[model samples]
Target: MYVQSENPVEITEAILKMDIRPKDLIVLLVAESDNLNLQALIDRLNEAGVSFIGGIFPGVIHNSTLHKVGVVVKKLQSVSAPVIIQGLNTSDYRWPDFTPTLSGLEKKVTAWIMIDGLMPNIASFLSGLYDRLGDRVNFIGGGAGSLTLEQKPCLLTPNGLLQDAAVIALLDYDTHLGVKHGWKRLAGPIVATRTSHNIIYELNWEEAFTVYKNYVEKDCDCKMSPANFFEISKCYPFGISKSNAEEVVRDPISVNSDGGLVCVGEVPENTVLNIMKGIPENLIAAAAEAVEETLNQSAHNDYVRHTMVVDCVSRALFLEDRHEEELEQISRRIKAVRPEVSPQGMLSLGEISSYGEGYLEFFNKTIVIGSLY
Candidate 1:
């Protein structure tokens, strides 16, 4: 359920009215624009004595529209309390032992992950998570942080609002995931010759910004500047090659002082990249396709189920007024399968999923829809 009010007391009251038992797990997705006094909310929820985990995102989704000043309160079923992993910004931080947590859960359960979007070691952290969990669980969730690209206290746990940290809840549910990004290659096969974590210093042995600007300028016949880089770069992202599936997109949010391109997620050294371009029609179609894929993967015959949509905030920005069309397509497709269920999720800084019996990944400019049954 979505609480339109941002007030901590009021939101907590609503949660209480829901009659959420002590064993129920709650996912509180907050909009960054709400400027919530997270501590107050946390205190209230704790006072009510309920287990929960959440994060502040660019926006929250309820039905087909996006809310910039509301909260999405979703109740989940987990085998254990949510685990908190700190020091995501530090490369050497030890990954905590989750054996005690996983040992209690079934061999194939769903894991809901929420992480700090601006942290540099997101890919590394996800890799470590997959290594520990193996293929025993399917992963679904997104990166949480403000669109301002600032790193701050975002993730929510029973302990407190945390920064440079992640929350992993081993849900006692099964989810079918569909991941897609309708970006076609405009230019490509450029190797990231010199790169650090999420910054690319060179592409094909040339200045990263220079190579990027050249291609974008030639395609649109316009001048590129740091001031307008983000505005223009939204239409053109870098896609990392993957064997049979769609190339994973990397959103270049800005150009640093050293002429390096800073992306939302990591771009490793020597990675081959393609400059991708998106059209509104294609993006909207891809969203519908995601719902169709999710429905196809689902094997349950139950009439009641839940749907979660993790779409990129940048995609919404690029779609502008037409973003609703993408949401509508998803809704229409989902209703065709489960008419009673509505699409609910967040406009995330980045999307995460273990795509199609494949490995876990952090993606940008993409849409991931997970249907829980």
Candidate 2:
């Protein structure tokens, strides 16, 4: 069931009071940027004494809530359980369980892997995960969120706390998932030309700023150039490729002043890009289509029950208050169309999921859904 409240601990208490058992700890840890509030939520997780771990994302999803980061716990009572494996004292316990999950499965199963974005080995970790999972599973979700000037982020751990760690949930079962990648296409008519690899070494084959200046235009554009990414961040987003389906598997992350694009995950080199135009209607259509596919793909007949969304924080900068207005209808549509739909979502930097749980060919794309029932 989808639920939300100001008190996560109370939420846990409610779950524990319900049919939730200690072993069924499939909790998701996405943090709110506010340090103090994040700590309070972490404190609740520690008290729960559940074998749970997750990386922080830009936002958290629950029944009807949108915006801001939060934590969620979904307990599978009568549902089929995905394997939960943790590496206690390994070199990097983060990807240990994922290898088996991806390698063995030939169909589809989704996994939620929380990671350390600042880690030097982060790209490597993702690579290992993608390699092992193969086409049988999909990868989504994200690295933890942080306001820290240092590379380290406060990871929410099992001991009533947060730490710098990684966790994975290998869900190989009968389930359905849905994902919506909404970008505000805020940048004006500038094009991402002369890009080798996914990194924009040069825009228009000229210095990056020159390319940017050409886009912004005018004298005010010069001074604003310093924080160009900051100003137009809401509208212009960096598109990251999830599936290899050319335009089909792509989304954008925002850029920063250091010439480094602060995308959700690493935007690999040589990735073709576009300085997109964000139209409100287009964004809504994309979201609706993604959600519809999930419903259509699963049919909600014998087993479809819950859906979780992973959205980007940059999207909010563009949509402002209207983002939720557009998203609420998403909830309504799912409920109206799918009788078994129990949808809860987070408007965060990224999401994780897998499809058909048993479909082996879905490996390595960004997983948007997983099922335990």
Candidate 3:
């Protein structure tokens, strides 16, 4: 259910009294930054007699705006479905070692992880964790935002909510196999002729600066500056690749002081990439397209189970004041079609999707577009 209320405890209480089976595995996504009385929320959960795993998000979702918080609850159908699992936000999740966290949970499939934006080496960490989910599971969702206050102290997790750590959660359900996500390069299909880790050395052999500058010039004529670059391409919104062959941020084209372009994650030397754009209209269409594709993989969907959108905050920033409009549009389009994509979602800092055909990317599927075709 899409809940935009500030009182999560009251919301939970309402849900529990609704004849929600006792065995239901409650997943409470408090997508707000309010200093949730952690102890109080936990007390309520314990009282509910339901197994739950969720955290506090930075942004709250009241009317609109992607940078908001809210709660989303999904009840298990038959058995205590273990389709989703959320692990502790502790130091055990280091680099490649996160592979084993899914050792026994691989069978559960989809993983919805939420971390703090300030978490060190998060994108790389997610890439490593994805490598371990085998090929059938998809890893989506990055850092969930919080109020500036929490940002100073990073919201704590079930174990503890603070910065400097990450949380890994898994979803296991037979009905869950219904979702899918894919990506195809948009703008350039521009092959990275030269590059580094997260830095584009050159594009088509032209100084990365010249190539991107020319491209931006063609679209918008403005005095270029460090801050101007972000305004130009709307924070380098990127395209997706399908073959799953590319690494790093495939479509991002950020501008450097010297006039070169800086991609988000990384781009190996000579890897083909695409400069992409998801204009508000395009984003709406993509939202629709994402649903269309998900239907391709799974059919006879009983109800549009709540969706957990792991959208890139850069996209959110790109939307600026219209970010709320964008989320509303997405929610409207999805609900218009599926009516179950959950009007509620989180504005993630960054997102990681599978390249090849190993894991079934989740966050990339429901709320994402063109990336998972």
Question: How far out, in Å, is residue 89 in model 1?
Answer: 0.8
How many clashing residue pairs are found in candidate 3?
45
The sequence of per-residue lDDT tens digits that candidate 1 reaches over residues 22-125 is 56789999999996688999999898897899999999998888889889989877877788988878877777787887777655778889999988778988
Give residue 359's lDDT in candidate 2 (0 to 100).
23
Model 2 has an lDDT value of 0.48
- Clashing pairs for predicted structure model 1, backbone only: none
- Give the poorly placed runs of model 3, Cα more than 4 Å off: 1-70, 73-108, 117-123, 136-138, 146-156, 175-211, 235-264, 316-343, 352-357, 360-366, 369-373
List the global CA lDDT of all models.
0.89, 0.48, 0.49
Flag regions of model 1 displaced more than 4 Å.
301-304
**Candidates ranked, most accurate by TM-score first:** 1, 2, 3
Worst 10 residues of 3 by lDDT: 364-373
Clashes of each: 0, 44, 45
The full ranking of all candidates by lDDT, starting with the best, is 1, 3, 2
The model with the greatest TM-score is 1
How would you encode candidate 2's per-residue C-alpha lDDT over 227-268 as one tens digit per residue?
A: 454555345444433354312122323344545344434334
Off by over 4 Å in 2: 1-12, 29-48, 55-58, 67-71, 76-108, 117-124, 146-154, 159-165, 175-199, 216-223, 240-262, 352-373
